[model samples]
Target: MKYAILTADEPFISLAELKSLLNNENNIYYFSGIAVFSGDYKNIARRSSNIKAIGEVLAISNDPKDINEVIRGKCFTIKPNVILRSDKDRFNALYSTATKGVIFSKKCETLDLIFTDGIIIAGLREEERDSKSLLLHAKKPYSQSGTMDAYTSRLMVNLANPKKTVFDPFVGVGSILIESAWIGYTCLGADIDINMLEKTKYNLKYFGYTCDLLQSNIATNCIKKTDAIVTDPPYGKSVNAKTIKIEELYEKLFSISSEILSKNGRLVFATDAKYDWRDKIKEYNLSIIGIHFIYLHKSLSRAIYVVQKR
Candidate 1:
């Protein structure tokens, strides 16, 4: 079906994540903050919170009479498709008459009107944006260094789209795992710090999420293969101590990752792009499919890499 999507401020990252989740590029079109595509985007409402809404296009406005013509019909549904009004005076004038027999409410419904550059598309609501309640719960119970925003974690995990199980090799306080479970994926969290693991358990139970958590450093543990991996490792430009270690740290790291990550399995992880990750992934035959640069501030920026084992 043809659908229009409203995206967030940092649309590039969210759009990339959405495209990866859709696993399609054809029939997908981009606008200022909207994406028009023909495919199964129904699952999108369930997957990511970044997408504001998805709907079928009913009507578009280019001619002056479009709004007047729609108003003339005078038949609106009980669960009416809202007017995603772009012009204030025009909407107020329409509102004065449109609600003459139509019901209106403040709550969110499934379908509504979308106005893109004076074009009006009427869409049946597929999914309202996922709630941030779970994210809020996660933040309240845990405090740590370099905490990824709940939304970013959700977007990253959605890109992975792990089925059966999702693993976080460097699951610090299990923030990513919480987002995974929110999207209905069984999660396993591993961290070298036992204290962090214990904290993860605390946070998980606080949110009533049952997760398999262990304290195993990636450098030492022989990890059993997992369906997918999404992690944000706490590290500097490089973990090397003397003049930056020569691929030793990442070689060992990706070696273990290759052992644990299943064939064709998806992985999403974050890192400073200046590291030796490319060489390390080359050794393990892992290929990066999507990479987005996230700007944190003037001095610091990071890259999120989406990977698949070849």
Candidate 2:
């Protein structure tokens, strides 16, 4: 079956990556992409066509029902195979495709419509309920630098063992921590900002996640060692001046990470700067496992690193 996995903003790259991730399936062919809120739809359409060569074009709106008309028309000439909806629009889209039973929904906030033999698959929200709500609320008022969406967190939990404890040293608003807890992992979160710590506490409680929150900086605090460390650290742009210098911040992060991370433990983190993090990994003697590039906005491409303690 030709499956389309919708990705976050500027999804072309993510779609390609998802295709590679799903490379085991010989029948899957990533045909096209549907973009939302992007002003350059013409350019995206042109790019999509250039990439897929013979794919259809569809403009996605806030309403899922609107897509039905386009899909029914087979405007792309490719039959409706399966629709992978983003987490943000999953609920409404799911309602729209309630009758379809073969749908496969990836835990992401982007939509990917797949075309198998012209049959749409059914989708169910897989991430824990409590975690999704908490992360949504946090992104509203105060923005974190390199935060993961609820679907990404769900994917992370699915990729890793949920039974293992996950720690977030720079747990801004506790999005990752709460999500980890919701997925049945013992979570530990710490932050330097008192306000963020307080918010993290409230959000965790709101999500009914019985996790630990520490008010110490990742640079100076003594946090418990864990099986995994999943964090979105402060980038040069979003952090305070004292913590903005890339070299200094990374130095501190390495120090703290080295101290608390257990032997062979996993550390998954993201950053948006142009720094050479590979050097830091080598300097710290950490084992590089995998790296993913996620385009957050038009200009920002976050580098997500999955490293293991040596």
Candidate 3:
């Protein structure tokens, strides 16, 4: 069935994250801010961090009357939500039909009435979640000083779409792994630092989730590759790869990844280094599908890369 994915505040990143979670399925079409795609219910029903809402396409037009009239024929015992593009006022010739339903009840359906770029679409909503509460719960009292936030970590795991298991080569304080485990993915993490691994253990226990974390070098990963990998490796800050050539470190990373990742397995990671490694990725039989840059400050920025074995 065709579905509509409502994007978050940052439309670009949200759209990219959603597309990746959909396994890079670019059958997506956009008229208004809503993104439309086709997928089975089992694949689409799973909760995703980037998807604000899901709906079935009902009609596409500039006039609200056209949308409202379409909904009128298929009456709902429940009043589905009437959400508009950018929360626009729901009116114009279809006021009577659009205003015929109750809200804030046990009803689970939604009507996405959006207007953007001179187009409007009406869709039947399926699911919605409380992102704020989830984030608040993730922001536990215990946190690493420079580790990635749980929200971004969750986004990365979501983008990777780990099926049976997920791994992290450099799981500092278990930020990504914690989020991955919470999402019900069998998680495994490795780090060269013993202290960090201990902290990771406590962090996972704090969240009432357990993960397999070991103290191992990235160049020699003991854990077998699984469905997906999400990690944040140190690039230039403390514990940087200064003892060895940065190029060599990256080479080993991709090489081991190529060996460990199963077919169709995804590896999503972030680094601060600004270098073109397309040739290196190709050498390892991997292809980079998506990359996003987060500008944190004037001196530093993070580049997120999503790649899969070719």
- Which residue pairs in model 1 clash with each other? 58-122, 59-120, 110-125, 111-125
Give the winner by lDDT: 3
lDDT-superior candidate, 2 or 3: 3
Give residue 19's lDDT in candidate 2 (0 to 100). Answer: 33
Candidate whose TM-score is highest: 3
The lDDT of each candidate is: 0.68, 0.53, 0.71
How do the residues 165-262 of candidate 3 rate in per-residue lDDT, one tens digit apiece? 98998887888887787778899999998988888898888778888888898788687668887888776664455476767877888888888888
Ten-residue stretch with the least lDDT total in model 3: 77-86
lDDT at 273 for candidate 1? Answer: 62
Error in Å for residue 10 of model 2: 9.5
lDDT of 3 at 307: 89
Task: Give the per-residue lDDT digits (tens) of candidate 2, residues 152-189.
Answer: 55444333332368887788877777667765688888
Q: Roughly what TM-score does model 2 have, to 2 decimal places?
A: 0.57
Q: How close is candidate 1 to the true structure, as a TM-score?
A: 0.80
* Deviation of model 1 at 206, angstroms: 0.4
